[model samples]
Target: MTATSSPLFRPLQLGPLNLPSRIVMAPMTRARSSQPGDVPNALMAQYYAQRASAGLIVTEASQVSRQGQGYSFTPGIYSDAQVEGWRRVTEAVHAEGGRIVLQLWHVGRMSHASFHADGLPVAPSAIAPQAQVWVAGDDGVGRMVDSPVPRALSVPDIAAVVGDFRRAAANAMRAGFDGVEIHGANGYLIDQFLRTTSNQRTDAYTGATLEGRTRFALEVAAAVASEAGAERTGMRLAPFITQRGMDCPEIIPTILHLARQLDATGLAYLHLVEADWADAPQIPESFRAALRQAYQGRLIVAGGYDATRASQVLSDGFADLVAFGRPFIANPDLPRRLAHGLPLAAFDPKALFGGAAQGYSDYAPYEAVAEATA
Candidate 1:
C-alpha cells in the first residue's frame, strides 16, 4: 500500500473525538499500582504517555467496586483516591496529545473469596469454574488461587451490580476519561450471565432462552450508557474465546442479538477480542458478515494483529479499527514502527504484571535505541 492510501494512517471519527490513525492501543492488565489502594500513579502515567501516538488508548480493566476486584494490584475507579490518581494519568496522556478511555470491569464468579467480606463471590448462578484468580497477601505478593463456587445474585443484588457499573462510569468521567468501555468478556460477570455453562439459573436471568441469558449484558450496557452518554460508551466482547468453561454454542446468536440492541442504543463501538493464542479457533467469515449485518456502529477487532493483517481487515471494509495488545505493551511507538517498518523490541514476560519500572515504563523508544547503538 502506498503511504497516501495506507488504511492504518487514515483518520476517523469515533463519537465526539477524532482520531489521527486507525490503530488503537488495546487494554491489557499490567498490575503496577499503589499497594494500599490499587491506585494509578506517576509511573503508570508515564507508561501511557509514552504510547500517545495511537489513534486511541483504552486503560486497563478497573474494578467498579471492592467486590468486583479479582486480581491483586489492579486499579479501581470507585474510590476518591483512585479518581485523584487517575486524573494524573489522564492529564499526562492529554499533554502528550492522546485520547484515552477507562475500561470498567467486574470479575463475578472469577473472583476468589478473599476479595469479599463474607467469603463468597457473587455471580448469576451458584456454579464455580475450574479457573483461578490472582490474590495478594500481606507481603504484597500475588498468587493464583482457585475460584470457589459463587452465590447466585438475588434480583436485588443484580440491580445493585448494575448500579455499581453506572456509578463507575460516572466516576470515570469525573476522573477525566474521554469515555468508558464495559468489560463484558473473558468469563467475567457479564460473560457468566451470557454463557449457559456458567449460568444455570431458572430465574429470568438464566432461563432456557437467549434473551434471558443476554438480559444482564444489555442491562449493564444501558446503565453505563445512561451514566456516560451512549455516544461515549463502548463494550468489549469475546464471541470466540471459550475459556473458564464458557464455550457455549448459543453465544453466537446471543451476541448478534446484543449487537442489534447496542446498535439501537447508539453505542459508539464494539471491540471484539479474537483469540490471541496459537492454533486458536478461527472466526469464520460467515460470522463476521453476520456481525456486520447485526451491528451498525464502529467495529474494533483485537488479538494478535500485525500490520499486514490489520491492513487486510481494514481493506476488506469489515473492521474500522485494529487493536494491538502485547505489541503496545513493549513498543510504545507501535503505530510509527508499523508505518516505518522498524524493528520491534521484545518484552520480558517476567516484568509483565505487578512489577516496577524494569518491565513497565523503562522500555526505551526506537530513537534512544539507535542513539545508544551509534
Candidate 2:
C-alpha cells in the first residue's frame, strides 16, 4: 500500500491472525464499569460491539489484580466474576466478527490507598510523589487529596506481581478474547520498573548495569508469551515518558534490547505509545529502525496519530499497524468515518474520564444517519 493512496481497506496479518484492515482501536479508560473492581457490564459490551468494524479492538487497561487499580469504576481481569463479565463483552464483539484483546495493567505508584483494595500501593522507589489519584465518595466525585506514600516493591513482591499477570492472562482466555496486550507504558508498573528514576533499588531488578534494569520486563514477556502463545500476546510501551520520574538517557537502546530479549517469545505485536507532550522527548527515527529490527513480529505505533500522519508512517514501513485512541471515543465506527470522511461528533472532554453513559455509549453511527436520511 502506497502512502498517497489509501490502502487501509486491505487486509494484513497481525501475527498469526488476518486483519480486514490496519486500523486498531487503542484502549482508553472510560471508568464506567459497574464498580471500582467489578466485572464489565452489558453497557460496556454494547460500547465495544458498536465499534467492532475496526480490524481489531484493544480494550481499556484492565488491572490484573485489585491492588493494581489506579482509578474508580474500572474493570479487572483477575476474579471469576470479572472473567464472566468480560465473556459477555467478548461474545458481543465476536458476534459482530471482530477481534478483541484485553489490555493487562498494574498501576504501580500511580495510585492511592483509597483506590487500592489492599490499602498500599507498590512503587519502584519509596520516594513520595506529588500526584493524586481521581476518586469519589458518598456525596460526589473528587480527586483524593494527600496522595498515599508508596511502598517500594521487595524482590519477593516483584515475583508475586509477575504471577498476577499470568493469572490475568489465564482469566482473559476464559473470557474468550482473541488475545491480550501487556500495558508497559504510560507510567504503569512495567514502565516504572523500566525507568531508573522510579527504580532506585539495589536489586537486580533495578540493575545498575543497563541489562539488569531490563530484566523484569524481559521475564514478564517470556512468562505471558509462554502461557498465551506469542501470537496471542502483545506489549505496549512509552519509552520517552518520565511522569513518575522515569529516566534513562539510553532509553531507545534499552527498549530495543528489551524487544530483542522477547524475540523468542513469538508474540503477536508490539504497540508503542508515542505521545506529543512538549516536555516528553521525541523518539528519533533510529529508535524506530532498531525496533523494527529487534521485533521480528508485527509492530504497531499509537498516540496522537491522525489518518494522514498515520498513513505516512505506514508508508515509511516502520509500523505494520496503527492504533487510535480518542478518535475511537468520538466515532464508534471510526474506520467507516475515516473511509467516508463523515463528520465526527465532538467528545465531551470533561466526561471522558469518569461519567454516566451519555458520552460513553450514546454516540450515533453511520447507519443511523443513513436511516435518518432515508
For each candidate in turn, the TM-score is: 0.98, 0.93
- The global C-alpha lDDT for each of the candidates, from Candidate 1 onward, is 0.91, 0.82
State, as a TM-score between 0 and 1, how close model 2 is to the true structure. Answer: 0.93
- Model 1, which residues run further than 4 Å from truth? none
Residue lDDT tens for model 1, 144-201: 8899998889999999999999999999999899999999999999988988888888
The digit string of per-residue lDDT tens for model 2 on 30-114 reads: 8878764567999999999989999999999999988898877789998888999999999999999999999999888888777
Error of 1 at 132 (Å): 1.3
**Cα-lDDT of candidate 2:** 0.82
Question: Could you tell me which residue pairs clash in candidate 1?
Answer: none
